[model samples]
Target: MTRGHFDDGALLAARLLLAGLFLGGAVQKAVDPAPAMALLAMRGMPEFLVWPALAFNALAGTALVLGVWTRPVALALAGYAAFTSIFHFQPADPWQMTIFVKNWAIAGGLLALAVAGAGRLAWRGGR
Candidate 1:
C-alpha cells in the first residue's frame, strides 16, 4: 500500500478506538445510569446532566466512527475528555489519578485527530 493508504488506515483505527470508548461509556450509562448519576451528585453537578452526557456520547461517538463532521466532533470530544478529567483528579487515589491522566492522553489523541481530519478511509460527507 501507498503512504496515503497507510495513513488512512491509521486514522481509521484511531477513530474507531476513540469512538468505541465513548460508545461503550454510552452503553454503560444507558444500562445502569445510577453510578453515573451518583458520580454527578457527588461532584455537585446536576444528575440530569447524565442524560445529555449520554446522548452526546452516543451521537458524537457515532459521528466519530462514521468520520462525519470529524474535526469539530473530535475537538468537542477532546474538550469533553479534558473537562471530564477534572472529575478524576483525586491525587490520593491512584486509580482516579490514572484515569485523570488517561483522559488527558485521550484528549491529546483527539487534538491530533482534530488537526488530521478523517483521512481517506473516511466517508468524506461533502467535505
Candidate 2:
C-alpha cells in the first residue's frame, strides 16, 4: 500500500524470521537438552545452570515468536547471544571468527528489534 505499510511489513517479516530461527534452536535444545548442556559445559558454564538456560531459551523464543513481551524477550535473547559468544571463544583459530560474529550479529538484530518494538504488522503490535 503506502511506504509506512511496506516498512511495517518488512519489519514484521524480519522479526518473524528471527523469532523462527530462535524458536527452532530452542526446540532442538528441548528435544535433546543433554547435548546442548554438554556443549555449554564444554564452554565452561556451570552444570547447575544448564536446565535454567534451556528454559530461558525456550520461554524467550516463544515470547519473541508470539510478539509477547517483545522488548524484554529480545533483550534476553541478546544477553543469551552475548553469553554464548563469550563461552565459545577460541584463541588459537583466529580465522574461525564466524562463531563470534554470528552471535554478535544476532544480538544486534535482537537489540534492534527491542528498540523498534516489532513494528505494526507483528502479532501483538499489528494495527
Candidate 3:
C-alpha cells in the first residue's frame, strides 16, 4: 500500500480507538449512572448536570464514531476530556495521576483528530 493508504488507515484506527473509549464510558455510565453521578458530585458539579453530561458524552461519542462533523466533534470531545481530567489530577496518588495523564493523552489525540479530521472512512466523505 502507498504511504497515503497507510496514513488513512492509521487515522481511521486512531479515530476508532478514541471513539470507542468515549462510547464505552458512556455505556458504562448509562448502565450504572450512580458511580458517574457520585464522581460529578465529588467534583462539585450540580446534581442536575450529570444527566446532561452523560448525554453529551454519548452523543459526541456517536458523532465521533460516525465521522460526521469530525473536526467540531473532535474539538468538543477534546475539551470534554481535558475538563474531566482535571478531576482526576491527584498529585499524591500515582494511580490517579496515571489516569490524569491518560486523559490528557486522549485529549491530545482528539485535538490531532480535530486538525486532521477523519480520513478515508468517514460518513462526511473523509478528509
Candidate 4:
C-alpha cells in the first residue's frame, strides 16, 4: 500500500481502538452505575459525576469513531485519559500500577492523533 493509504488505515484503526476502550467503559458504567457511584463516593466526589463521565466517554468515543473535530477531540480524550489515571494510582497493587501506566501510554497515542489530525479518510461529520 502507498504511504498515504497506510497512514489512513493506521489513523482509522487508532480511532476505532481508542474509541472502543472508552465506549466499553461507558457501557460498564451505564449497565451498573452503582460501582462507579461507590468509587466516586469513596473519592468524596458526587455520585452524579458518573453520569457526566459516562456521557463524556460516549460522546468522545463517538466523535473519534466518526472523525468529528478530530484534533480537539483527541486532545480532550488524551487529557481525560491522563486525569483518569489518577484513579488507578495504586502503586502497591501491581495491577493498578499497570493500568495507570497504560492510561498514560494511551494518552500518548491520543496526543499523536491530535497532532496528526483525521486525514482525508475522516467522515468529519459533514462539518
Which one is best on lDDT? 1
Give the number of the best model, judged by TM-score. Answer: 1
Q: Any idea how many clashes model 2 has?
A: 0
**Cα TM-score per model:** 0.93, 0.79, 0.88, 0.91
Ranking by TM-score: 1, 4, 3, 2
| Candidate 4 per-residue lDDT over residues 1-127, each given as its tens digit | 3458889989999999999999998999999999878867866889999999999999999988988898999999999999888877887899989999999999999999999887667795566
Summarize candidate 1's per-residue lDDT along 12-73 as a digit string, tens digits.
99999999999999999999999888878879999999889999999999988999999999
Which window of ten consecutive residues has the lowest lDDT sum in model 1?
1-10
TM-score of 4: 0.91
Residue-level error in angstroms, candidate 4, position 53? 0.4
lDDT at 62, model 1: 95
Q: Flag clash pairs in model 3.
A: none
What TM-score does prediction 1 earn?
Answer: 0.93
Distance (Å) between predicted and true CA of 125, model 1? 4.8
TM-score of 3: 0.88
C-alpha lDDT of all candidate models, in order: 0.92, 0.75, 0.84, 0.90
* Model 2 regions lying over 4 Å from their true place: 1-3, 93-96, 125-127
- Candidate 4 pairs with clashing backbones: none
- lDDT order, best first, reads 1, 4, 3, 2
